[model samples]
Target: MNHGAFRPIELRAPEGSVVDVRDDAPAGAHGEVRKRAVSVALGALSQIIPDLVSGDLCGTSFPNAIGE
Candidate 1:
């Protein structure tokens, strides 16, 4: 089965931006940072693919596990 023609794809993170945070701010707080980033990304993706992502996003059972 032919998949189809190739299409160009590009992904970039700006310098010093939150999407690509600098090293000096906080290394230990990466867990919080990661959650925020995922929310932003998944929020965007859900708009286009809501069904696939519907049940994928949920609250953590162990809320305090990540210092949240």
Candidate 2:
């Protein structure tokens, strides 16, 4: 009756390597990861900050990043 267990994958990349893109490609790739991370963090914060301040956790989640 194990319902919460899961497996993990092992991925390793060497230094100075493009883990996400092809090697030695001229690409504006750094912003995508950061932007996604920030967007997700802000979304989560929006869903939690109201309850954290007002002590009520019944509010629906809202999209904090309007331009996404």
Candidate 3:
């Protein structure tokens, strides 16, 4: 096996946040963990709720707002 050619990679979270895990977790588990972590973080932020629910925070300008 050519071990020299392999390198460890560091994963990064999106621009506005930090990642909690970088180990060899499965894709589905990673996604669920990330989703729950994001939900909790955003829930703590609180003010982002309306914009998240409204979908206009991203500047797409939701025509009907959520749950219309």
TM-score of each model, paired residue for residue: 0.48, 0.33, 0.32
Cand. 3 Cα-lDDT: 0.46
Model 3: per-residue Cα lDDT over 3-64, one tens digit each: 75534535557643435443453343444455555565556556754543311232222233
Model 1's C-alpha root-mean-square deviation from the true structure amounts to 6.2
Q: Write the per-residue lDDT of candidate 2 for residues 4-42, one digit (tens) a residue.
A: 452433556565654455657644545554455446555
Q: Candidate 1, residues 6-67: lDDT per residue as tens digits?
A: 33345488968765778775466556666666676678878997865533335333334466
Q: What is the lDDT of residue 4 in candidate 1?
A: 45
| Candidate 3 Cα outliers beyond 4 Å, as residue runs | 1-28, 47-68
Models sorted by lDDT, best on top: 1, 2, 3
- Model-by-model lDDT, in order? 0.60, 0.49, 0.46
| Leading candidate by lDDT | 1
Q: Give the range where candidate 2 is weakest over 10 consecutive residues by summed lDDT.
A: 51-60
Q: Quick one: best TM-score, which candidate?
A: 1
- lDDT measured at residue 21 in model 2 versus the true structure, 0 to 100: 55
Clashes of each: 0, 0, 0
Better of 1 and 2 by TM-score: 1
